[model samples]
Target chain A: MADTESLLTTPLDSLHRSLGARMVPFAGYAMPVQYPAGILAEHLHTRAQAGLFDVSHMGQAEILGDGAAAALERVTPADVQGLKPGRQRYGLLTTEAGGIFDDFMVANLGDRLFLVANASRKAEDFALIAAALPAGVTLQPLPDRALLALQGPGAAAALGGLAPALTALSFMGVAAAEIAGVPVLASRSGYTGEDGWEISCPAEQAETLAKTLLAQPGVAPAGLGARDSLRLEAGLCLYGSDIDETTSPVEAALIWTLGKRRRMAWDFPGAERVREELANGPQRLRVGLKPEGRQPARGHTPIHAPGGAQIGEITSGGFGPSLGGPMAMGYVAREHAADGTALELLVRGKPLPARVAPMPFIPHRYAR
Target chain B: MSELRFTKDHEWVRADGDAATIGITDHAQNALGDVVFVELPEVGREVTAGEAIAVVESVKAASDVYAPIAGTITEVNSALTEDPGLINREPTGEGWFFKIEPKDPAEIAALLDDAAYAAFVESLA
Candidate 1:
């Protein structure tokens, strides 16, 4: 067993402490969960403007060798070979039984494949990927780099003034550039479902770059509190909470993430199971749920059917700052997966009225 | 002031035989920080000593406040439904959580006093 304390650290630890951030252990690293501004204020701030998030704990790595793409393909159910240079794709990694290990983003850089996995699951993902790789392939973990996400509608314009090259970069595109003269790997991607950029830079220089970006207009420092709510508004899944090894991509409602090319031969681990689900659909499906009122239906809240029959349970939930209402994402019987089907969440043993709805509760603001 | 009582989970109570008003200490709320949602206990529900009575959610985490002593809930702070931040502002006053009818008053004496709670909170820091 690996000691989580030996996991990783970002350069901005002192800066986060200085800002009175409520530091919490996340993904093996001590990270800021929220600031003194609080999660609600930070959440609303990001929705109205831009929020600077220190996601440096996220794992960044590079796959080296001629079989880099093919090696990655053996573990993940994504067509990495077809990915053009500078383009990134959201994909799922699964176990031998078709259970998802993690969901991550992979980018082709013409030479090496850029891999970014969740911080908490990075070590496991690396081992899984390495175990499945062919001989002569090299997996270099770039834990030395830090990743930051500047999200919201104001993000694009803020980057436009600092990194003009980003102005031409469309959504899902990456560019090796510099922000305010600091070398950075900037990508137009985010989990907040907003127009933003994920910047990868040297771990030692992150604090300086973060401070520089924070100095920009309309950019406020956000914490993990807002990060969760913002991603909930966007209908994104939290790796450990919403999706885990026990849950399959289809059951988690992430079927679209599996590229058709990769699904054909089902070479990836758990391919047979994933293919079965794709063909006949999973017994239960994850769906978006909007409560009838301001009260939220959180994780572990049991989902009940028409006559109060237990159907499923909520996985992730929160009050969406942008949507102005309560939203949740959970899995229930496939029979109850319709957009207008009525459901209930058993909160504190009392059922709270809920309705199945489409995701992206507040809509996405990508620079498409 | 009424005789103050405490719980191991950090809830404070002022009992008058049957009716006991409960609230978290100022140190507890400060340690938790910026409470966003509070799942309050419902009236007329019977709760046992040391059992979870309410859930308080901060931005990043969720914690439960348990019953200090066995009792039946008589009233809950309805105001917390719309303004959960009151716990951050006045945890001992307007933020008072609930009132319970304790089945046993002797349990109240077993709790810590204000001075002891102060020491416990300091140890955590």
Candidate 2:
């Protein structure tokens, strides 16, 4: 609820306003929360067709110098050292205690490593990463760039005409290509579980590229409201809400991000503790929840056993528009993390029946 | 049409002798945005004016719907149970939350009239 006067504006600011988007301050930027179509319609539209998003607020940077990937490995547990060129990997920056500081995507652009971190945590993540860099490596923030995501089932068909090379790219693949005469680094990856692409380009060319994408058939402009719901249904973690400095990667069900080589070396930050947890398992685990009714049990709702023992708490909860029911994700005791286990959510002091369900509540449709 | 009255919380009530029907105003539904679920009080339940009597859930958040006047619940709208979007479509007609038997029919005049409610909504902007 801070004053909009102090907020930063992205390259698509005027375009968003002209399209009747409801602008809200997010991560210090005046961003659109929803358009005139509303959140529900925007959400369902993205699942069935295609949705365009202006993600220019996210931080873009490059890791340069000799042994850049090896230097990054000091702070993150991902296999940055062995990452193939033109490939992208999802990773986490961990605290000394093995707690995740931020989640990021790193694309090996052949010559330099292209890194993208969360909007709010970019500053902190960069500072931590910079301090951990060895003598030859340097992190340069890309302040002159902009980011956008084109997502859904119809996204490929809409964009494939401009760049035929895009059709060959697999999920998590990255390539530097020219789309409609604009040079861009298009990564076949997105926060939503749908098959999609996130394009990084110069700030000056952002509005032009976005306009071109929106003109494509079946592609409509979507905002952060639909983006949040889409990612939640995909069971993707929102940095501050779902995972934070107090939650370790293992506890948050992100062990898949730790490469086999990284685990064997056990030399990254908080490696001792992370290795111990990897072998023995964490005391608590993050799991998906399906509330047994139409009523949504929102974040901070307490989870209780049948007789009423506080076991865990809901971190992210809302109505999944595509599924036509309320869904939630939370952390509970490992023993209670099994799918189909009975649980209850305390909503307005009333116990609402819920069950532990498998995630990506709607199965991911990402390209293999 | 029965005489309509409004509450400060944006609920509107139409009172016809002892029976009254209640629902959130058009302004209320527009502000809430895309209602997905509605939970109303049980029929025959007694309620006081200004008490939280029902819940309206939207894609953005859940809001409590307060009773406009003291009454005993009579009938609830069953159409909203399957499709809550009616609140966004026809908030004053098909979207009526529930009906009740007023404890005192005279209380209806004390609430805001149509003109007064329009002025109140304008003042908020």
Candidate 3:
């Protein structure tokens, strides 16, 4: 409700157009789906070398107050109080009924907690935080800043050359520094499941930072098409697409993200239901499914058991360009979540043979 | 060789006696960007005018190629199995999807001629 449909623009819009990118409406922004290099090449490029992505449309903000962490604790179950400076954690916002509203990343900067959330859910997330926080804590949205992701094995080297301090930050770590003389708040985390960095800087300085990063030897401008495929390869969940109000973290196999302290205290939103589900496993869980053929199941494909009984539906499905096969991720009955369980995905009315497989069908190569 | 004609759906056919070689227009292929997969119609299949006969999937999206006229499939372009990108590279040559024996050659006459197809392409741009 907070002006979510307003079609935001990133600093690199002109650059994407100049590179002959096919722009499409995504998360209320005119983002490039693919470029002339095609998605396959871009997918492979991100896994091998560094790929620069304009993630400016994502929500980046700062939480301020003496009890900011305590106030945020009401909505999110994550133990923000225990977070030390420079460390970050993956957390989720939930409704009172225990449905996941959105999954986000939170990092403790020196005096404030920095949070980055999905673009489409930003307005709702901010409103929820504002409504939950006490008078002392103020929700500060960083309107003048944009975010960029540099992902791949070579990202560290490319970024380190620009700012030597970047190389010192470990995985899930944050640091404030200058890249090529432009100030930035960068974190050693990204969605690609590779060792990478997410750089946040003022909108006016974004163009210079992007140009400097793209000028690196191994860095190339990657579009959203490759980003989706790459994240799928990494076995990361995409909010709104992979999980929504109807899905719970436990059912999504994301219960591990809930802190042990938070679970025991049950102070977060929907804690009773979440705790009950944890005690007795959720009725369903998200699992990786690999089909036998080249034709992908894509989203909304019906998943069935041996007798053509509908058991679940595919949430995110596509051809894994890097894995060289068709892959999908969907929810199935908890009893059927085990790997190697044979299933069928009804594609275009004909059932295709598929088997439950452990995810990242391509194993993640994170730097740890 | 009777003549080459085009359907409004962007399919081109070169009528030879009662048979025709069916392929997409150069303009259609260019618009498709990069061809990644081609679903060809099987030989001996029957199709009605304007009915979808085959599918052409590019890197971005999938498109159905309609039958230019009522016809029976005679032969298919097997070359696409090894190299589907040929459609993007050469929409009128090795990229042809299949050949058909037309049930009514008069339907071909009603299709767009080269000049008309050229004008249609220009109008689209």
Q: Which is the leading candidate under TM-score?
A: 2
Off by over 4 Å in 2: none
Tell me how large the interface RMSD of candidate 3 is. 2.3
lDDT of each: 0.86, 0.91, 0.86
Q: What is the per-residue lDDT of model 1 for residues A50-159, given as tens digits with 9 covering 90 to 100?
A: 99999988889989988899889888888898899999999989888888888899999888889899988889889988877888888899988989999988987778
User: Tens-digit lDDT track for model 2 on A1-368?
Assistant: 47999999999999999999989999999999999998998999899999999999999999999999988998899999788998999999988888999999998988889999999999998999999988888999998899999999999998899787876799999998887677899999998899999999999999889999899999999999899889999999999999999999999999999988988888888788788888898888999999997988888999998657989999999999998999999999998999999999998888999999999899999898
What is the per-residue lDDT of model 3 for residues A208-283, given as tens digits with 9 covering 90 to 100? Answer: 8999999998998888888988888788899988999888878888887788899888888888788889899998
B-chain TM-score of model 1: 0.92
Per residue, candidate 1 scores C-alpha lDDT tens digits across B1-125 of 68676765889998765798998888788777667678888899999989898988765457889899888999999998788889999998889889989888788888998788878777766
DockQ value of candidate 3: 0.38
Q: Interface root mean square deviation for model 2, in Å?
A: 0.8
Evaluate residue A69 in candidate 3 and report its C-alpha lDDT on the 0 to 100 scale: 85
For model 2 chain A, give the 10-residue run with minimal summed lDDT: A159-168
DockQ of each: 0.34, 0.67, 0.38
TM-score of 3: 0.93
Model 3 chain A TM-score equals 0.97
